[model samples]
Target: MRKVCCIFIFCFSTYTTFAQNVASVNGKSISSKEFMWVYKKNHAGVTSASQQELADYLELYINFKLKVIDARANNLDADTAYKKEISGYESALKAQKKTSPKNIEYNFIMNEYREGVLMFNVSEKKIWSKVHDNEEKLLEFYNKNINQYNGNDFSDARGRVIGDYQQYLENEWIKTLRAKYTVKVNDDELKKLAKL
Candidate 1:
C-alpha cells in the first residue's frame, strides 16, 4: 500500500511537470512542449541556436500569441471571412490526412498553412482592410508615389499602388503591435532549448 501510494504521487508529479505551461497571455496557458515542438520544427534546418537566439524567437512567438489573442478579442476569429478560409483549409487537411496518414511533410505543410492563414486574417483586420477601404488614401498614395508606378493610367497602376500601400501599412502596424504587447520569456525553458 505504501509503495502504491508513492508510485501514484510520483506519476502525478511527473505528469504535472510534463504539462507545465511555458508562457501565458492574459489567462491562457501555452504549454512548454508545444512551444518547444514549434521552435524545433521551425529551426530544424539550423545546426544550433544560442540562448539569445532562442530568447528572441520566444519573443516573436509571444508576439504571435498576443496577436492571436487580440484577433479573438476583436471577433476576427469568428468573422465570416476567417471562418470560410479556415473551413476550406480544414477540408484540404482532411483530404491530405486521408491520403497520407503518416506524412511528416504534409503535417508540416498543414501547420504552415494554418499559421499563414492566422497571420493573414490578423493582417487583413489590422492593415489590409484599412488600406482597401480608404480609396482616397490609396489614391493619395498613388499620386505621391506616382513615379514608382509604371502604367499608362491610374486604372492600370491602381493594383500595384494598393499592394505597395498595404505593405507600408503592414510595416507601420507591426511597429505598433510590438509596442502594444508585453512579452515575457521563461529563461529556464529558453536555456533548455539552447542546450538542445
Candidate 2:
C-alpha cells in the first residue's frame, strides 16, 4: 500500500508540472516557463504583492502587450505627434535616470519645474480653455450640476463652483473625445498570465 501511494504521488507531481500553460498573446501560445520567469522578474520582492497580487500584475502586463499590438495595428506608432511625444518622454526619463535619487527633488523643481511655468501652461491650454465667463453659461453650469455647487446660492460657492464646473466640463470633453478611439483586451491571455 505504501509503495502504491508513493507511485501515485510521483505521477501527480509530474502531471502538475506539465499542466501549467503559461505564455500566450491574443490566444497564441508562448513558452510557459519563460512567461512565469518574466512575470516574476517584474514583480518579485514587491512588499505589497501577495500571490493574487502577483497574478493580477501579470494580467496587467498581458493587457499592456495587447494595447501595444492594437496601437501598432492602427498606425499610431508611425504618427509624427506620437513619435515626438514618446521621444520627449523617453529623453525626459533618461535625463532623470542620470541624476541621483537624492538630488532628484532639486532637479525636478528647478530643471524640470516641479510645479512652475509648465503647470501654468498646461492649466491655461488644457484646463482654462474650458472656462467661460458668460452669465448664461455659469447659470447653465450651476443648474446642470447644482448638487456639486450646492450652497445657499451663487454667492456662497461662486468662485469654487466656477473652477469646479470648468474642471468638470474639461473632464466630460476629454471623455467624449476618447470615444473616437477603440480598445480591446485579450481575456484568455490575461487569465493565463494571472496563473503565473
Best by TM-score: 1
Q: Residue 119 of model 2: what lDDT? A: 34
Candidate maximizing lDDT = 1
Backbone clash total for model 1 is 0
lDDT tens per residue, model 2, 1-196:
9999999999998555445543345544434444454555555633333446545665554444444444454555576865565557646766877655466333443332322233343445445755655567667777777787545477676787788777675566445433533333334444555544
Q: What's the lDDT of the predicted structure labeled candidate 2? A: 0.53
Please give, for residues 1-196, the per-residue lDDT of candidate 1 as tens digits. Answer: 9999999999999556544755665555656655666777788767468889877777677767766766766777677877788778868877756645366555555555655667768877887778866889988988888889765466788878888998888667656665675544456666766777
Provide the overall lDDT of each model, using Cα atoms, as 2-decimal numbers. Answer: 0.71, 0.53
TM-score of each: 0.58, 0.36
lDDT for 18 in candidate 1 is 41
